[model samples]
Every structure is written in structure tokens, then in C-alpha cells.
Target: MRSAHRAPRRLTRRHLLGLGGIAAAGVAGLAVQQLRSGQAPAEANTSPGRAAASGAPSPSAAAGPQVVAKGGGTVPYRPGRTILGSYLALEGKAFTESIALRRRQTGRDQRIVHVFYDWTDTLPARIAGLPAGATPLVSWRGSAYSDITSGGSDARIARAARQLKRQGRPLLLRWGWEMNGDWYPWGAARNDKDPGAYVECWRRIHDIFAEEKAKNVSWVWSPNWNSAPVAGWNSFEALYPGDRYVDWVGVSGYNLHRETPDALFGPIYRAFSARKPLMITEVGSMDRGGRTKADWITLFAQWVEAHPAVGGVVWFDTDTHPGYAEKWRIDTDADSLAAYVAMAKSVRFSG
Candidate 1:
């Protein structure tokens, strides 16, 4: 991983562009100013403009190599080995210990440690406990996505933002993610009463975080890859709270049907990658075709090489849930694990 902070080298247009957003801010500022300037809830509807870890090395502590991380702070694009990450867990085990064990078993230094944070959880303590170097990419899910729009959970949400801010370090915060789908209660399929509720809720949550000055968070706006196969729902565009409100665009894509990354997720990947750095926040391949899971990993590596916009990938290591009807855990068999291990050691994955 590399620190985005660098001594100013030869200043180019790109350098100017990167320095405090003369260009990027134009778009981000539009949405921010409008959104934060106290526009009425009804009137506030609009488009927006556009970490990890631990007790280990602070970014300033490392002046040698750049370490790209997820859920930490914003990472500069390096165009090299893409970050390899995983959603690690073991029932009845402590989060930090479980994640560390899985990571060490592979003999790899994972850039991100994915975890779930429900409303009752404390974000700072959890993030701080991870293995020394891993960044926390927390999937902050509320039982209902309407909490923000309803004004029922604003306090709880605000405290979460404050907790994250209090940590005073980079952390990836994924809130009410996969809103485009209907399967989850907070998803469009059920609890999101109005189509616009998702967007409004997301914006309000983000605004509160901003109000509290929680700048250490990288707010990841994530969505499911499958189309609203259900009716009365919004598309990705409508659900999008705009670039200003978002830091990174992440997607939950899985090879449940034994398809390649491009086939299952290319459409959204293509659309969003051009606008923002992308992350396969949650991805996995099922056990299929004699060696389908392994094959998918191989193909994904190829795809990562071709797509520079893809900043990182975190594999979904959990077993298939009830609705999915697939096994996503890469360690299911020696073959699949071998494929992943080889990829981990290759130049394709960043340390």
C-alpha cells in the first residue's frame, strides 16, 4: 500500500487536479453546498459532486512504499497490484482474532478487513481492534433503510458517524448498502416505502456525518449487481445520492451463476468506474464447472489487469446464505483455495 500524501513532484495538470480539487471540487462542491446549505427536505433533492486500521503504522510513519487500503482514508490510484481483501469471521470468536487468523493462514497481508456493524455496535472500538495493519471496511446495515428518511434513527446514526470520527483515522464505512435490491428489508424490495426514500435517507445520513465533521470516513455507496427484478423500485441513478455525497463506489457482485466478472458486473463497473474509483466490495465465485470457482478467480485477475478503475477487491468468504443457493467461500476445497492463494502471491494483489 502507498500513502496518497507525497511531496509535490513536478506539477502537472493532473497534479493540479489532485491538489485540493480545483476540478473535482467543482462538481462535489455543487452538491455539497446545495445539500448542506439547508435546502428543505423536499427541495434538497439533487445530484452530488464527488481505512484502516489499527495501532500499526500511521500513513506518515511510512515514507517508503504507498499502501493502498480500503475503509481507511482515501487512497491514491497506483495502477499496480490491486488490493486483496476478505470478509473474515468465525462464529463465537472475536472479530479481530478471527480475521487475523484467516489472514495469516494465507501468508498474506490483506489490505482490508471486512466486518458488519449493526445499529447497536460501536464503530471505533471495533475498527481499532483489527490486526495491526488491516483497514476496517464496515458494512453498516440498519434493519430498515427508511430509518434516515423517517427521522427515527438519526441520533443513532449520528453517534455512529461521531464514533467513526472520534477514531481519528481512516475507516471504510458502508451504510445501508445494496439498497438497489429488494431481498433485504432495508433494500428496495421491502422497507424502503417510497422509491426516493433510499436516496433521501442516504443523503441525510451523510449530511449528519458531515455536520459532525467526521472526515476520517470513506463513505462507500454500494449497490447490488442484479437489476430491480422487482417492480416499483428505482434504478442505480435514482438511488445514487450523487458524487459529492460519495467517496468511493462499491458493488456487491457474485458469480452465483458461474459467470465471469465482466459478464456479471461489467455494466455497472463500466458505468461507475469512469466516474469514481471502484471496489468489488463483496464478490465470490460458487462451486460449479469442475473448477468454476478457480476459473472465476483466474478470469477476475485478468479483468483487474485490464481495468485500472478497479481499486480493490474483497472476496465474500461466507457460505451461501439461504436465498443465494451457492457456496461463495473460496476455502471450500483445496483447488479453490489454491487458486486464491496463487493470486494472493502474484503481482496482481497489493500487499
Candidate 2:
């Protein structure tokens, strides 16, 4: 694992996007309403001018729900079963030891292990340290969109793809995730706000992986639950690389404040649940504002049960920084750990 350096609090994506503010201002109430009504909030303007300014395709050109390609590379959809997983930060601890501790604490075997790599980093050999039968969900960050689409990153991408193929086991590859947000270099907001560039970049990499015959890899396309800029152009619809290129649709959502699972994932479930196998690619919560994490986890389990299209969830179970306001680790407290254990051990999440 790479050195554990935390992003400064001031520059954190959630803080910059005012998600906390939304929760503070009663967005959770609206989210509950949305969940009950099976409706999403009104979308932003999709006018041609806005699309052009953001370098996104017009709504007419954006792809909607359609029949997607299926094959050995895709994850098998199980209607009522979800794979429970987690991303463990090194945080000065040995990776294998950390996994062992997590297993002992949760009392359930994680089916997926989440790992991250930068655009220039090689696939770490340490993946072999993961528990037997656990699949790896690799979140590979990308460089600038133009750099990628222009073939400048081909060698690097092909190298990773070849490495994955050598693994000889099914793996989930999430490339350039959270592109709707402004935090990463590959995000549309940083790449001339051009969602088209993002799509091109993704397709180019997917093609390179195909050229490498990485058939064991399942492509995962993930975005933040809400756009950072909160604009139509940055919406998931505008940034989608289309169903044919995506094996799974995922979202990163966190209850940084008082937001509930319905508030965090309702809109995403409503939009793409029918189009692709949906997963909560990244999720966590902070106990705050008189809300208990235990109750929140119970509600989240119920929500997933009510929505059958969701087949996987990866918890962001790490406290990245000291004194962080959001203690995301599942075992932050005994109650939180108990709640997570119950969720992980439940038949619905049992793989």
C-alpha cells in the first residue's frame, strides 16, 4: 500500500461540494420524500447552451437505458444477493494484518477487497495477500482526459490490463471513478469541463484492455451520487460511457452528516437500477446530529433489500486522517461494529 496521506480538510471534495450544507439544510427530509415517492429531484437545465458550455453532449445525444452486452467479463446479476466488501487503509498497519483484524471484528468474510492505484502506479503484487475467494475491486485513477484519449497513457494502461489478465480470476476494474466531481484531475470540471473527453478517455482505455485480452476484468463505471458543480452537464447521464462499455454501474455516497441511505442513493437507484447492475461502490457514515450509526446501517440494509437491483456494496471502512469529523471505519464504536456485523452476516449480503 502507498503511504497514507490524507487530503486536507479544506480541499476535501465533500466539503467543496457543500454536501454537508445540503444535509444541514434539510436535504435528508427531501431525500426521504423522494425514496417514498420513487421520484428524483428535478434535473438541472439540459439546454443546448449549457451543454455546449460544458462540452457535454446534448440530451438528445446522451445514451439512455438500453440493452447492454453480456459475457464472461460481466458480473453475474443475483437478484437478492449482494457482495459485502471494504477498502482498508494501511494507516501504518500491515495490509494482511489489517484484513485479519477486520475479519475478526466483523465476524464475516469479505467477498471483495477494494484497492486503489494512480495512473502511473503498477498493479501491486500484494493483491495475493487478500483472503482466499475474495475478488479485488481495483479503482485505477486516470490522468488528464486528453492525455489518455491521445494514446499517451496506452503503455501504462495496457500494462495494468496485462497484469490483471495474468491474475486468472474475475476482478472489478473501476477506472476514472467520480468523474462528475471536481476533486480529481480526470474529472470533467478539471478537464475543460468536457464530459465528452471523459467518455472518449474511458472507451480508449477499455479498448486497450480488450487488446490485452483482459477478459477476467469487469468494467465498473462509478460517479459521486451528486455532481460537485451540481449542473446538468456534470450529471451522471451526461458523463456515462454507455451501457455497452460498462459492466456495472456504481456510485460513491457517504452520510457525512445526517443523510440517510435513501437520501444518498435513491436518485441513483431510480435512474440506473434497471439499466445496469447497481452497486454502492463506496459508502460510509458519520454519527452526528443526534443520529446513531447503528440505526443508519439498519436503514441502509432495509433500503438495499427493498431495491433488488443492487448486487454489491463496498464500504469505505477507513479513517483517513486523525481528528477527522467523519469517522468512517465500521468499528468506530461497538454499536457501529455490531451493526456492520449484522449487515455483513445477513443472508441478503451473504455471497
Candidate 3:
């Protein structure tokens, strides 16, 4: 069933600053490397010098499940193992504090920390301070599809590519996510209802990254589970940028009502799981009607176990606007927190 309400636009660092009229944070020590005219960096390798320069774990670092793709230059995709991750809002110390609390409660370090970024925003220097071994899944919002395809945003796009390349480690980059929905400007409905424009826009950005040789990034093409307009034009197939442009296939499915994980994500899985690794890039549930949030969490774990192709799941564990009537934070109470802890501790998620 289609959602009656569109998924809320997530608050990012830029949004918070814009709302409060605060100055944008400077890039600080994060430097953007100069790109040679037409040359891109070499494809990923496991060299000691390369690893050290990129902030990747040295050979001596205690190795858990590898998130890096086998041949270097792709996302770490572990078959039969799923990685657990979360998106805690980046407000002051709350990001770090919440992460620490999760670790303390779950006895497991989150494999990924999701953060959102505006098209014009610089890569925040604070990303360097993420807990050891955590990869940052950056959800980058884009401008108009025409603006990007017409070369109007080339400078901004290249600058962002350079910054990501400078990061030097493997990270997931999800751009123009949830485009199947009508909420964001980049969505098909907002962009003249032309799905082809969305494809062209996506390819343009991916090509720019390729030109910069930002090979450390794994491109995640994500859509909301249900289309907003629920029409043929906005279907998942129409919005997809094709396999060559995407490294990971993902969907944002939230349990706003009493839907089970299968009900929320099964269609997406059947459609795209065979094409590439799947990631539930954004997922959260609230206790609704008569269902308990803890029971939903337990069922979600079971769903992941049954669906072996799902390589990762990032929980949207932050309280959102009250108008949405959703408190998505996992640790809302003892029972809910315990269920989440059990899910985290399960061997199925040990990626």
C-alpha cells in the first residue's frame, strides 16, 4: 500500500544552520586534493601507503567482516552477512554520544554511520572523528536535474568529488535518494515529471566522479519503497540509472503503520536483489495502533536473515518533527532498546 504521507525531508547540518541562521562550518583541516587535468586516481589497491593515506585500516588492524569489495574500488559487499548501521542526527555532541550509547547497549560497533549533505555543503571535518572502523554513508541531496545535466552545477559537483576522494577510505555515496517520491526537488514529480531527466542527472554526477577518479566511493542508488504518485512513469525501473552507474541498490522503507519488514521491502527485494547488493539505506518503525515496536524489530531481524542478498540496514534512529507522529529512535524504552540490542548482537548482522 502507498503511504498517505510522503517521507519527511531529513534535517541535515546545512538545514539546521539555515534554519537557525548560523554560519556554515568551515572545512577546517579537511583539504581537497587537486585533480590532474584528465587523470583519475588508480583503482583501489591494498598497498600499505595507500591504506595509510586513505585512513583505511592498516593490515595490523583487527579485521572484522570486510565492507570493501574484493577487487578494491567497490563497496564492501559480504554475501550471507548483513551490516547494521544507523543515522543519528548530527547535532553537536549528540552524534557521538548516541553512537557510544548504542555500542554500550548492543556490545557491537555500528559498521556504518549515515549522514545527509546538501549539494553545496562541504564534507564536514567532523567525519574524521567517527568511531574507529565505521564507514560514513553520505546521503547527498542534489539540485534540479536540468541544472546538473546542463553543466550548471559542474564546479560544485567536482568540488564535492574532490573532497570525497580526499577522504581516502571506502564510503557509500547516495545521491538524489527517494526520487520515486514527490517530496524532494530532485524527485520525478518536481522535475517536470520526466524520469529520463533523473537518469541523465544521475549519470552526469557519476561521470564527474569517475573523471575525478573518486574510486573509493560506492554509488548507492536508492528510492522510497513506494512511489508517491504511484504511476507507471515514477516506477522504480523508470527512475533507475542503470547498473553501470550504481554500485549498490537501496530503498528507504519505514514502518509507519503495522507493516512487517517483508511487507515494507519484499517487492523491492524481488525486483532488484539480483542486479546488485541491496541495502535498506533508511529504515525505522514506530509503535502504531496495537502493535509493539519491539515485536516489529524482532520481525525485521528475521526478515533480514531470510533475505541473504540484503548486505546492510541503516536505522533512522532519530526523533523527527512532531507533525509526523513518529519517534524513530530505537532506544525509546526498555523493551524497544532490548529488541534492538538483540538484533545488533545477532550473528546474522556480523558483517
Candidate 4:
């Protein structure tokens, strides 16, 4: 009845010692606050104006179902031209790749990339290494997802929200994304495989963010495909917190388990259709499957085009799996690339 992974825990001494590489990574994390800034380190020749701009709000804004207040004013969430960007590994590559992708999407003309801000690395102790107003990290580990104060503390969440506001960027935050399944500590079914606590935790996280006046943030609530025996109708929605906290409805799905694109993604599309914008936060066809990248792209495009409510889809570019290697590439699969290009160009971005 359970099928998700748990959040990675602090490494043990043996693993820390044996896995010297990861140990160094941990230390590296602690070594410099700059590294946690979520952007490339500052250069010696940098100008002060640019540095100041880092603290300003980001220009890339979108529309969604939720509304946030800025300077005591309210705004709605709208979908933008979002490219599925990776964790830190793809941060730098985003600039070049995003530009190329944008160029390719000229026919469609959407101007944005829906990015994944890997909390551990990007949300550092200080902004020394980050660009300014970058992605903020709100995690679901501990009881943060189910018990607001259990994992995510109000103070910490407040600080992150304040920092993002100061930087002047709109945040598309997906906290404890795939909660229905059991892999993560915040998974809905963890204790008794029930979702009550999970919903409580989600509500709590929302309270903290809202009270803190983190106006530039847009919350995206996403869960993996419902593979549990009950077809994923877990009680997670009980914790929705409300339309106040959520701006978009999203799904972290893949072309795994013989799921038809529509079947796998339909529930979410229907669930949040009237209340919020919808997105495919993470998805890719695996290589091990008989499906080829071109075929997957065609299928995905055909499916997306059929859904008028679906605002956008962001492809998870990781090639870590078999059939997925060529999936995220912008050029390898001509058909897929062309489809993305077309969509990007056609969509109207929300600022």
C-alpha cells in the first residue's frame, strides 16, 4: 500500500567516513555561506548596482490560482513559459540552455523556466554566493509537511520568506511535493499510512509563510501519481490549508508504470481546474521502457494540447533512468524539441 522514498537523512559516521566524497559535500555545505546563496559566487569586478539588483524582486513572474500580497497589495498566480530546470547541477546550465530553448520555442514564445530550487544547496545560511531573490527552500522533512512545527520552524520559514521578498523575486515553491506516496518522511501514509497528519503539516507550513508576508511566493502543491491500491485517493487533500496558501496544482509524474499520460495526469487537472493553474512539475519517459523520446514527445504534446486547463508542463531533464536519457535533451529528439518550442512560443506569460 506504500511506495515512496523517504527524505535523505544526515549521513552516518561509517557512511560519512567511507563515502569521503559525500562527507566533503556536507562539509562544503557548511564551509561557505556563499555556496548556499543559490547563484554563482560574486566576481571581483562586479558592480554594486548588480549586487543591489540581486536583492530586488525577480522579473519572471507567473499567474496561478493563489493570490499573494506585495507592499500590502494582492496579486494572482498565472502560468508562465517555464522550462523544467534541475537542481543545483543544472543551475548554471539553465542560462545557456534556457536561452537556446527559448530560441527554439520562438514559434510558441513563452519566456520563462519553471525551476526546481534544491533546498539543501540553494537555501544557504547567507546570500553570499547566491544572485539575490533566488528560490527559497521550504522542506517537508521531520513533521514540517504534516506537523507545521515538527520539521519546518516558523522562524526559519519566516527568514527564508523575508529574504526572498528582499531579493524581489516571485517564488514558485513546491513544499514536500510528492506527499501521497511513502518514500519521504512527510509522506501522507507514513505513520498509519494516513494523510491527516500530512494535511496538518501542509497547513502549518502555509500559516508560517502567509503570516511572514512572503508576498512574492506562489505555492505549488504537487503529488506523485496515485499508484497505491486505492488509486492514490489518499487523505492528503484534507490538509490543503486553503486556496489562500496554494497558487497552482501540480503533479510530479514520469512515463513509468505503463501509465497513459492523460490517465496519470488527469486527476490533478480535474481537481484544481477551477481553483488554480495546473502544471506537470516533473515528468520524463524512461529509456528502459520500449517508448522512444520522439514517441513520448508526440504523446505528451498531443495530450497537453487536448487539455485546455493545463497551463504548462515541465519535463524533468534527468537522464538518471534508462528510457529518460534522451528525454530532456532540447535537441536530440527533434519532435519533442519542436513541440516544446511550439508551446513556449504560444503561451502568454503572467508577470
Q: Which candidate is the best by lDDT?
A: 2
Reference-based TM-score, model 4: 0.61
The digit string of per-residue lDDT tens for model 4 on 55-156 reads: 112222353433222211122333332333322112234344544444455433222233333333234232222323233322323343423546646666
Q: What overall lDDT, based on C-alpha atoms, would model 3 receive against the true structure?
A: 0.68
- In the range 1-351, model 3's lDDT, one tens digit per residue, is 011111335644222111111111121111111013221111111111110111111232354323333311266778778878988742233556777777888898889888877776785434744778888888888778888988999888888888988878788899988787766788897888899999999999899989988888899998876666666678887888987888888887765533445545666776666557889998876664333677668767877887877898998876643244456788777778888888888888888
C-alpha lDDT of all candidate models, in order: 0.60, 0.71, 0.68, 0.45
Q: RMSDs, each prediction?
A: 17.0, 6.3, 17.1, 16.9
Q: What tens digits encode model 2's per-residue C-alpha lDDT throughout 195-264?
A: 8899999999899989998888898999876677767778878899997898888888776555666656
Give all TM-scores, in the order shown: 0.72, 0.82, 0.78, 0.61
Which wins on TM-score, candidate 1 or candidate 4? 1
Model 1, 1-351: lDDT tens digits are 011111122322221111110122232343345346653111111221110100112223334333223222354344555777877544345556656666666786667778765556665544545566667787876556555677888888788888877766577788877676544566665763465777788888889988888877887888765444333354566567887888777877665433345544555655566466677888876575566566557667767776766777888765423233345667777767877887777776764
Off by over 4 Å in 4: 1-147, 150-152, 227-236, 287-291, 320-327, 346-351
By TM-score, rank the candidates, best first: 2, 3, 1, 4
After superposition, which runs of candidate 1 have C-alpha atoms over 4 Å from their true positions? 1-76, 91-101, 143-146, 191-193, 230-233, 319-327
TM-score preference between candidates 3 and 4, better one: 3
Model 3 CA deviation exceeding 4 Å by range: 1-73, 90-93, 289-291, 320-325
The residue ranges of model 2 lying beyond 4 angstroms of the native Cα positions read 4-72, 90-92, 289-291, 321-325
